[model samples]
Target: MLTSILLRLVGWLGGGVFDTLIGRVADHLRQKASDDLVRFQTGVQADTQIALAQLNAQIEARKLQAQIMEADRGWWVTSFIRPLIVYPCVLHFSAIVLDSTFMFGWGIAKLPPPYDGYEQAIILSFFIARPFEKVARVFAAGRT
Candidate 1:
């Protein structure tokens, strides 16, 4: 009878200990799952914010491109119109002056030919003006 009672008591204590351990394990697992869920939510929020920033950047870039296109159109119109109005008038004026000077004989012949510095000045002016003319040609090409 004594042996039977001792065995029964040992069995009950062992069962209680096992139940307590199982409860602790379940609690630990629940805590870990809660932490994982929080981390996942935080990551999702961060990703959403990043996506929104990227979308905003794309919108701004498109706006800038539209502005640049408008400016380019304005430049194109001015480039064509200015040369159209200015070049022929300037050519006509230069031709008239040359013709009048040649007819009257009161042109470069009236000025004393520089015996010393004139030749150098003419050469230098020609070189400087040539590059300017090439630059003007480049601008004209852009218009067409």
Candidate 2:
């Protein structure tokens, strides 16, 4: 009888707290979704701009190459080197932004109670390791 009474009290308290938590979580998730949408749109716009710039650079490089050929200079290293440096930097910047988006998404997922063990651990690990991973990848790619 005592155990039954205790269980009933626990259930009552749990229900109220759980409902409150759920409401808050719902609001948080809605806000995060809205934010993610905005971030995604911004990322898309940035990516488009980067692509356009790369295309323009490629065209200019071709033009320079042609001019070099016409002038019999035999050296147009600037055109080749500029794009090689710029494109990767643009790509890496975009990647970092996208990764931040994912990190925010993961963070929202981990915020509610009754935590998912693997999801929590994975999100935490990703947040911790992302910077190191970026640095390692950059260095390994033979870029300074």
Candidate 3:
């Protein structure tokens, strides 16, 4: 009878100990998973912030390019160049849009691929990069 009681006591204590060890392992794993999730979220947020900063920098650069052009030039011939190129392109685009929308079938000749590429380069440079040409007098006058 004594042996039987001792065996029962040992089995009970061992079962309790086993249950405690399993619970501790489960808790540790849960905590580690939570920490990993938090780390991943933080990393993603940092990446997003970096991307946004780069985009903002590009926008500011374009704005500065336009501003610089506005400040750097004057006089009729110098000023006339921008509108000279821009107006015709604008009109051409409008005509294309109208023809396509109304199905006018005017068959307005679209700018061929090479010419279109050249046009894009010209427009982008005028609006988004430094002015292509500057007067000799402006440079001689020592003005930036």
Candidate 4:
């Protein structure tokens, strides 16, 4: 009788333990599935946001191009503008060179403040402006 009672007690305890272990496993699986679903939903939302941002940037770029086209004046008026501005600076440089060669040991022709500023500005624009513009466009693209 004692042996039979001991076996019965062990079987009952084992059955309860097995049931509890199964319940714990089911709960863990359910939690893991829930977590995975949330992650998937978040990723989908992020992808949608990125797509929208790209579309908006494209729209803005198109608008900028349209504005530039509208602002363009005729070629006749624009063609002479650069030459008109640059010719005086060239003439001034030539005069300075002639004065220095003809009048050695005398003072060099001093550049007027306005002309000096203009010369520097023109030189800088000629050398570095286009590269700087390209870098700016790259940075702008990254931001978008």
Candidate 5:
């Protein structure tokens, strides 16, 4: 159950940068429409989208902050914990079935296509971001 939750959380959290980008894009388009009003475009549609997204992002971001932090904490903490939980059970069960067979006695099947990169990007992003954030966070935190 925890594994399932972690997998889902990783996928969901990984999409956050896209969410923020979309919110910013909405802001940009709204600005452009207002600036390009020679066509008499009210920019109302874009403005409405931007307004709604700002509110939505703020509320949703606050509600999900904890899961986001946990997901971002560390690569090994989440990534390795998953396989550590899965591999043992998989091996124990497979061992019983494959012990006498000619088939390889201890292996999981290979992932297909995009699913292969799922763990790599989701987990690695935390690792990559952690150090960058530590350095940059000083600016955000302010100093004496």
Candidate 6:
């Protein structure tokens, strides 16, 4: 009689209402454990796959970070470094410097100085590293 009364009281309080909820939770836990066990049994391949996926994601994130850093580095290197390195080395290597604006008259007709073969490189890099360019534009427009 006592056992029957206690069971009825427990059922009335929550046992009946929570039975399906408890079962669902247990099912989810079981599925997760089974998946983890399968993954573990796959040995190094599973770990390697996970690590490779993470590294690929990191590569993309690092690329974006690199762009941010490049933008911050600004235009000094682009303007000065490329010309200093390229004009002497690539354009007129071992040749005598006949003029400052044009070296040995071996330059383009209207391309001007430092605009040989790498003008696109100079222009693109110049605009890409443009944190100072922002300041210059603001000052030029007299907005600041």
lDDT top scorer: 3
Write out the backbone clash pairs for model 4: none
Error of 1 at 52 (Å): 0.7
lDDT of 4 at 13: 81
lDDT accuracy of residue 106 in candidate 3: 80
For 19-93, candidate 6 gives per-residue lDDT tens digits of: 777688899999999999887889778888999999997887666556655665568767566556545443442
Give the worst 10-residue stretch by lDDT in candidate 5.
135-144
Model 2 agreement with the true structure over 95-120: per-residue lDDT tens digits: 55666777644222222444344434
Model 1: CA > 4 A from native:
1-13, 75-144
What digit string (tens of lDDT, one per residue) describes model 3 on residues 1-144?
999797578758888886677689999999999999999999999999999999997887666656655666666678888788877876777688899999999877779999888777776766666433434433443344
Which should have the higher TM-score, number 5 or number 6? 5
For all predicted structures, in order, the TM-scores are 0.43, 0.34, 0.43, 0.41, 0.26, 0.25
Residue 21: error of model 1 in Å? Answer: 1.0
User: For residue 40, what is the lDDT in candidate 2?
Assistant: 100
- After TM-score superposition, what is the CA distance of residue 19 in candidate 5 from its true location, in Å? 93
Alpha-carbon local distance difference test for all models = 0.65, 0.63, 0.75, 0.73, 0.63, 0.62
TM-score quality measure for candidate 3: 0.43
Clashing pairs in 2: none
Where does candidate 1 clash, by residue pair? none
Expressed as tens digits, the lDDT of each residue in 37-134 for candidate 1 is 99999999999999999999788766665664465447776858645644544454455578686775534322245632453444444457646765
Model 4 lDDT tens row, 102-129: 8755455667889688876765674568
Question: Which has the better TM-score: candidate 3, or candidate 6?
Answer: 3
